[model samples]
Target: MKMSKAAVLQEYQKPLQICEFPLNEELQPGEALARVEMAGICGTDVHLWKGELPIPVPVILGHESAGRIAKLGAGLERDWTGQALQEGDRVVWASSIVCGECYYCRIKRTPTRCLKRKAYGISYCSNEAPHLRGGYAEWILLRAGTSIFKLPDNLPFESIVGAGCALNTALHGVERIGLEMGDTVVIQGAGPVGLAALAVAIESGAAKTVVVGGPAHRLQMALEFGADAVVSLEEFPTAAVRLEEVRRHTGEFGADVVLECVGHPSAVPEGFELCRDGGKYLVLGQYANAGNVEFNPHVITKKQLTVMGSWAFEPRHVLGAIQFLARPRWRELFAKQVTHRFSLDQASEALDTVRRLEAGKAVILP
Candidate 1:
């Protein structure tokens, strides 16, 4: 058996241990092995390292990835949307595999909330079979029924890595809320998710978009990504000040929509304060259990605000994200968001850079 290199998380809050594992060179009935070109270190990955999200130990930690197909299994002929697939085609795969029979999948039609969903990098244990499950390794095994999308020749890997799961997640949330033309949007936290939400809001024909978040660099990128006005967390220094700035931009009516893209618990209550009467508040962050915050229910009733929470994305959202990135306006700017790249051996360093908010979008190039 051939061996592949992987960075294993043996314990929580510790650096990944580099090790070699036997590769399942031969594909099963519908499996495909992709040689990882670049894997992104998402904010969720940082949360996992901090033990914010519960998971099985001895796992290879990475989910946002892109690569070339090394091989394919029998009976697999086309991509997820019916495009032809072949060896050496550049591709990106959906992160999770959902059980189609679950209530959320069958009845609610929300496959992302399927009861028995198994995510590629997060759920797969390195101690199990087909050990090359995560993108932090040289190769990842695409199990049966995984939705894979072939990349066009002109599409750069940096664009996909720059957006990563953030774009897909934003696509899902925006679709849920239904962006209308000339809508005024206020987006909180200028991280990848926030910036991606800004991009979506602009494309959805938002008349004015106010971005709140920062360390200066991200807010600058938000402007470049088409935010009409920006409120810096560093400049404001408090939620009250930030809310005042947003109100100023919205002419004291608040905003048509306020999106909480920052995963911090404190951002939740403040997000409610930014929404106008009868406005919609979309919470795209708080995906992991980052603890809880106490907030009064009276705010919801008093403001007549619609509160909606979006979870992780589905495969169609990933496909839509690719199409959105393929646009000329987004391709170049999105690529620039990937400011840092490290080799697979430096996975620990990549996570640290993201945790410190020092890098735009950190990627691991194997």
Candidate 2:
């Protein structure tokens, strides 16, 4: 057996250790091995490293990855879209696998709410066999039933990895709120998720878009991504002032829709304030259990708001995001989102960069 080097998280809040595990040269009946190209360091990865989210230890961290097919399982010849698969084809796989028989999957018709979901790079353990299950490694093992997507020859890898899961997640939230054409949208946060939400709002025909939350560079990217106006967190500095700016950019009536992508519980109340009467609010950034905040329910009642939340992206959303990024204009801008790159051994530094909001989108090139 050959060994694959992986940066493993042996303990919480400590630097990831570079370790070697035996590589499975021969895949199982329905498995495929991908030679990892790039792995994106998401904000959730920072939360996982700080032990803020529950995850298996001794794990290879990274979920957003785009790579080429190293090899396919014996007799498995087609991708999820029924595309013929061959060795060395570029691909991107869905991060989570859901049980189809679950209540959320079968009854609720929302597999994103599936309780028994296992995600690559987050749940998979490096201590186990086929340890190269995560993206922060030279290789990723796509097990049986993994939703493998073959990339079009024209779509650049940078576009896929730069948007990464953020685009997929924003797609989920945007769809849930049912953004109307010509709707005025106020998006909270200026990180990858918020930026992606801004892109979606513009693509969805939002008449006016305001992006709130920033640290200068990210706000600039939001503007470049086609935001009508941006409210800098450093300038506004408070929820009251930020809400005032949003109303100013919009009309006397706030916005038709508000998206909370800040990943903080405190963002919820402000999200309500930003929405117009009968407006919609979609929260997608509370991906982790980041406690609760006190919000007045009377606000929802008085505003007659339609508030909803989308937990994470489904396989379809992942495919949609990829196709969206493949467009000529989007392909160029979203690809530029990958501002920082790191080697696999520098996973800890990559995590810190995301934690400190220093990169547009940090990716690991193995």
Candidate 3:
């Protein structure tokens, strides 16, 4: 009998309790078991730890991951893209599984908004059957409908684990705003999601991309990821100063698009101010309701800015991200973003590193 180790979050704002449990060796009809090789800790996990994002307790916390197929069930013989799946094939799976019967899934055709959606690590409680549903564990059980993509041999694990879901999240945001060629884009925040947005914007043929965020390392990464200019909060120190620099790049007018990837409610007003009148503003980072801010609604009307908020990403977006990473140009920059790693037992430490902004991306090797 095989046993698996996992870090279970029993309480918010506390250390994760490590536990060992028996693995479910038998795969049900369409299910598969993956031996988790690397699992990336995301900003959402930090929010979940602080009790900012409400979720069921006693969950294994990790969603951004890639692994090798350990056991393929009776029915699922191929990957999501229809490639044959065999034991030991490197792969990455989509985080959320939607109920096709939901109104959002069926009527609106926006399955990402499925009312009964269950996400791995976020929605699944460890008490449930097939207990290893999250990447923080040594194994993850892929349920039916979960789209898995086989990784190409040349693509390094750092490329997939580097951007993780942030790439797909950025992909969905760019898709929502319909960013076009030669557009000027200003990306606010230099975290994983922000960096991902910058890379995607540049790849989409934006003439110029300016990144506003801080400390020093993240801003440097923004430059490496192909930002035309970067505004470090260490230098600007205030929203007003940062806005001035961003406006300078946009000339007399503001940026054609402003991506709010900071997730702070207060950043919305700043991002709005950086956008040109009639420009587009895509809120990609506020996937979690961290808090609220008092902003003048008049700005939205006066600027005539097209506002769009992207939630979690769909499987297609993940497919798009994988394709994006396969490109050598993007992979080089993304591979630079992977800055730290820890063992499964060091899950809490990894989360702490991310919470403190100590690393670009932290992954757990189980």
Candidate 4:
């Protein structure tokens, strides 16, 4: 007879309605429940709110969260990494569950592209069974097929949720287009994904990194996360000027790798211009189709660029992110990116903070 409260998105471009649900004292086989500690507001959530992505309404909206295990089902005894799961163990779980029989899942063996995949916060309806399916709630029910991983005791909730899905999304993108030792990287957005990509690139042994994006705080965080140079959009104020600033840090030929983490199609042309002729251009930030852009296809041929796009992350990337963040310095750096916190009822405000790009990171302490 345990009741939990959650912030449900009743409609797009509308305030999230606070709702309550009852949790079963006994969990079904292969399921687990966690008491949500912190749920990070992701850029994707903001996109969903704007009706950019078609998500089921009356849905609870928080994909990146960490919590203490409350109850383990009959057969669910271990985390994704095979660690034993106890009631009090700290954990984070995958956002989506894929259908194993899909063409993308079975034939291609690429589950990330599974068209039938259902994400916790994005896909599930609030009225569905095990109603507390998102982290914007007091509790999140880790469904049967979801990969739940137990976090180490030393890792704080803020650090794991700080980067939110950005870390794993960046991880997948990096893996999709490999980063080399001593390569120069230019990250074209100072958002969470860009910052996480910067960290990942530096960790992967990039000789230099330049970040382009900003108000002021996000650029500062990029520096803290270890960027060699930062191009302030405010200072540059134009794509042409920012391109020049990026080239200054990267030298005459521009960076070896340029990451488009700006989530807008308009940034695509700049990404092309920011890469060295034969280098790579990675597009990972356009999760939702913002609009059309008029980038020249001739540049792809002229530059001989290895153009790549990473859609979303796989569960293994989550494990990779956890292992990467386990480092004390990394954990601390990411945790520092958390600039705003709100209660579950303030979910709309949290989304607004992210929408305006006001915080390095915003979270709901449900």
> In terms of TM-score, how similar is model 3 to the real structure?
0.98
- Superposition error at 365 for model 3 (Å): 0.5
Task: Evaluate model 2: give its lDDT.
Answer: 0.90
Against the reference, the lDDT scores of all candidates come to: 0.91, 0.90, 0.90, 0.91
Per-residue alpha-carbon lDDT of model 3 for 12-46, expressed as tens digits? Answer: 99999998777987888889999999999999998
Writing each residue's lDDT as its tens digit, candidate 1 over 34-108 gives 999999999999888888888888999889999999999998889998999999999999999998998999999
Please, what are the lDDT tens digits per residue for candidate 2 over residues 188-260?
Answer: 9999999999999999999999999889999999999999999998999898888888899999899999999
Q: Candidate 1, after superposition: displacement of residue 216 in Å?
A: 0.7
Enumerate clash totals for all models, in the order shown.
0, 0, 0, 0
- Assess every candidate by TM-score: 0.99, 0.98, 0.98, 0.98
- When summed lDDT is taken over every stretch of 10 residues in candidate 1, the lowest stretch is 21-30
CA lDDT, candidate 3, residue 55: 90
Q: What's the true lDDT of residue 24 in model 2?
A: 83
lDDT of 4 by residue, 1-366 (tens): 879999999988999999999977688899998999999999989888888888878899989988999888899888888888899988998898899998999999889889799888888888977788888999998888789988888888999999689999999999888999999999999999999999999999999999998879999999989999999988999888888888888998988999899998888898899999999999989998687889889999999999999988888999999899988889999999899999988989999999999999999999
Clashing pairs in 2: none
